[model samples]
Target: MSNAAVLWRRVVAEAVGTGLLVTVVVGSGIAASSLSPGDVGLQLLENSFATALGLGVLILMLGPVSGAHFNPVVSAVDWWLGRRTGAGLTSRELTAYVPAQIVGAIAGAVLANLMYAKAAVSWSTTDRSTGHLWLGEIVATAGLIVLIFALGWSGRAAVAPAAVGAYIGAAYWFTSSTSFANPAVSIGRAFSDTFAGIAPGSLVGFVVAQLFGAVVGVGLLAILYPDAGRAADEIVTPHTDTTTTGATT
Candidate 1:
């Protein structure tokens, strides 16, 4: 396929992936909150599990097309790792994916609102007394970048969806930030008053931490697997069609 076609595919994949991801995250949270009002924590746990599964499946389904970015941070990290698509993306495509993700996230949040009118849409605010939340964000984001680089290096980018999903679900409980790992998802969740919301001011800290974490993750990958950079120069000859959804988790 031509580079232009590939870029367009990437944008569409971002939109679909973001839309689906938001639907799963917000929609499931809304269901859990309604069904188990007294057990908000458990509801979040349930949502995380489902979100992980959906993420894995979506990755498997769409990784071949658009490289299954779904998250701007992932795209940025890929660029840093030297694995972003070539002609590579111009500022225009980069701009396109982020907005697509943000808009798609908003659509998901809005849809959840329509679906669960009785439930709260905005996330709750707390003092965040646990200092671990920041630490968790750092670790989670770093781990995410490392995994992406590793997958790309091993020429197993096809399974990124499942790999990412599993990481996200596991990280939710393990990391203090509940693995709000993706910047776009974090921003989208802010729109809802549901269990997932991040306070308006809080986004800055979280995003900064995530960016730091991504840098740390990729930095380590560079240190540990320096040869991967050389390997990255070779074009990845995709075995499946761009639209193929047979990827593994």
Candidate 2:
């Protein structure tokens, strides 16, 4: 295949993976809400479990294709850290990946709502704007970045499916904002009005917090694993895996 063709394939994989991820996240939440009725904790448990399993599977399936970076923040961090190292994505890939992830995430939410027989594009009313919530976002996103990059440095790339999945599951409970660490996913959730949704009005602050968290994550990487910022012969990001197909988490 030509280089352009390869790039397009990767881009397509990213879009599909992200879309499916949102489908799993939003769909499960909607179902959980209905099944559990008024039990908030149960609903959250159902949603978190489904997300953990589904995300891990998606990463395993698509990582070899586009590094399965369903999250834009992950893609950005990967590109930033790996720009100089051949282990990371090129600028063109970074540009392509982030947009694909966002588009896919939105599509996924639409699909989830439709599957639940709801409106295709209703905005969420769940207002999550608050100082403490923003702080939670920053904490969640920063921890995510730190863990992912740290895996690369530790030469534990193969465990990313379990590690990343588990961390997200834990973050959902420990963090106040339910850990909307993925910017693309959060934007997509804004278009949903179901249990997993976030208010559109709150997107700006959440995204800002996430970005700041990414910076903090990078700083931590420098301190704990100074050499992890650049890619090495090993996989540079959590998105890449042991498969020859180039699967990412």
Which predicted model would earn the best lDDT?
2
TM-score of 2: 0.93
List candidate 2 segments past 4 Å from native.
232-249
The C-alpha TM-scores of every prediction are: 0.83, 0.93
Candidate 2 clash pair list: 63-246, 63-247, 63-248, 64-245, 64-246, 64-247, 67-248, 239-248, 239-249
Q: What value does the lDDT take at residue 157 in candidate 2?
A: 73
* Candidate 1 local lDDT, 153-244, one digit each (tens): 78876566677888899998888888887788877777777766677668778788888887888789879876554333221212233433
Tens-digit per-residue lDDT, 61-85, candidate 2? 8876666778888878877777666
Q: What is the lDDT of candidate 1?
A: 0.70
Q: Which stretches of candidate 1 lie over 4 Å from their true place?
A: 83-92, 118-131, 230-249
Per-candidate local distance difference test = 0.70, 0.84
